[model samples]
Target: MASTNAPIYDELFNVLFVIGTILFIGMTALVIYSLIQFRRKPGEEGDGLPIEDNLPLEIFWTAVPAVVILFVGLYSYDIYDRMGGMQILSNDMHSHHSISSQEKVWGGIGSSKQESNTSRDFPINVELTAMQFAFLFNYPKGEIISGELHVPVGQPITMRMESKDVIHAFWVPEFRLKQDVIPGQPTILNFTPTRTGRYPIICAELCGPYHGGMRSTVVVEEPEEYDAWFKKNSKQTEVEL
Candidate 1:
């Protein structure tokens, strides 16, 4: 599973787990206790009273459970707020963009949204195009972008992804993140890989015959090491292709 750096999410989850276990045990005990204490028989006297309407007990169960659920909800919301993120990027609010005199009309690059533009700070921009059977990552040169993606640990990397033929979902189980690559529409998914290890990146959708085999590995490494690997891979990509 994707690891989380947010301690509050972990703490809230632990509290929830504990409460759930308590609730489970309480429900089980209630069942067992009722089975034993209220077992009906002919000789039973004043024991088999029908509890069709116990207002106090009903209110107790309802209110207590509601309160517990409220606690969980409030705690979860607090955690989400703390873990959300920096506002340099958002659903709205972009920098004023414009086409350069040179590469004029590259669409959104120099579009009017360039004022508060979040795309500019994406350390290394990656264009991920998903086709029927594979995901091709493109990195433009003269700007230090490369085909083989290399990321520094704990830095947010945005993958500007889209599809050529059909919709495909990009997911990494270890990071617990997924986003769909839709045709004619670009999707931006930004995530920072905190762990230094190789993780599996798989297409979590059924696209075609090779859908199951459409998988890749994202290798996270130290900042310096990542730079070295990027340099090596850039050379290799040109020499090979």
Candidate 2:
């Protein structure tokens, strides 16, 4: 896992896999047992028994599924809450006065409830725009624009993203973070990259005929390296401006 959030998702997946495997094996065993124990006799082919309703069996089956589903629902909800999925968007998102012309605020995976209680520095904010076949990243602080994303390791990153034309998705599998970029609605994605390496950024949603080509790279680097890169890029941006 390259990010802190990946383990939470992986744990959820593991739990689901274990539950599914147990159910599959148990059901297969029951089928095999029924075939052997309740099959027709060698030469006697008559209506053996007329069983109306097995009340206990019915209750067992229904209760088992219900309990299992309830457990899953609660478990999934907890995971989502931990990932900060329960953080609702602001009510004024649709109001034109609340946001600037260049950006519209939409809620997404933010800091978890637990994280919200702790005192921490603000995350590095970057604006991203997804077009038909490209992802553009802009660092508002430095007035720098880049085709690829660059960030320091071990720090929180908040991506404010939107789509220029159609719906697209920003997905970084290693970090276990994905968010849709809707044309008129901006969204945010928060994560702390723990590994210092290059990771692929893919558009998980199909937006256009060339959706497959909408790809970019996120370069996670040491704090010093990132600072140097940022300074260099910002200077160039200044010259261009």
Candidate 3:
């Protein structure tokens, strides 16, 4: 499935991969050149000229990696912030402001109605409960489904997840989204699927003996199709319950 976050992840991967490949090739060439040029030939080696370190060479090596790391760090942080990693900090700031201003925070404490409404515009909210070897999804309208998550294409989806027993991870590789499901601490993942298809959901964390079995499917469909499926499933769930 095409995802909103897929391009960001792909760009980051391409940057890192290019940098790594260049570094590896350069280092290998340097090693080979040094070995061939400084070989012990004709008794011309006396402790390798006392091995004096050059300040320029030392500075170059140190500064290059430092700069590269700084750039990558800032770039990754931008991506993380865009993916809602900074929501926690935003919550804290809102909390502080609410206390200081003596004004009730709209939509409840640690909640931003503006931000929520913006991100959740026509979005489907799904609650994911992680257990030993399975995932259960609950829709906002009280429909529950096991082993499958259904969302409408071209609309936003917010998954609020929590673990029942231990820590688990919700990962959909095709969507380039993953979030930890911690016990007693809820987490949210917001994404909009651009394509309509069935994709796999994987548990990336080692939660239990059957962690390998923690797998499910996400079905993205058109709005009308999704509505029909949801209504039919809701009725079936009501009948079963």
Give TM-scores for every candidate, taking all chains together and pairing residue i with residue i: 0.66, 0.85, 0.81
1-241, model 1: which lDDT tens digit per residue?
3334234446777899999999999999999998997677777666555558989989998999899989988877665444442122332322212212232111121111112224334444566788887877765432343334556676655556778998898877776566688887666655566688888879998998989988877777887797666666564544211
Candidate 2 local lDDT, 1-241, one digit each (tens)? 8887889988999999999999999999999999999899789878878889999999999999999999999999898778877776553422323256555355557455323222433467688999999999987777789999998888777777888999999999998888899888878777888899999999999988999999999999997798778888884544211
Candidate 2 C-alpha RMSD relative to the actual structure: 4.3
Residue-pair clashes per candidate: 13, 0, 0
Model 1 C-alpha lDDT versus the unseen true structure: 0.62
Measured by TM-score, the strongest candidate is: 2
lDDT of each: 0.62, 0.81, 0.72
Poorly placed runs, candidate 2 (over 4 Å)? 89-104, 113-121, 236-241
Clashes of 3: 0
Q: Which ten residues in a row have the lowest lDDT in candidate 2?
A: 113-122
**Using lDDT as the measure, which candidate wins?**
2
- What would the per-residue lDDT of candidate 3 be over residues 59-144, giving only the tens digit for each residue? 99999999999998998877666655666422333221212343221211112221334333344667789989889998755445
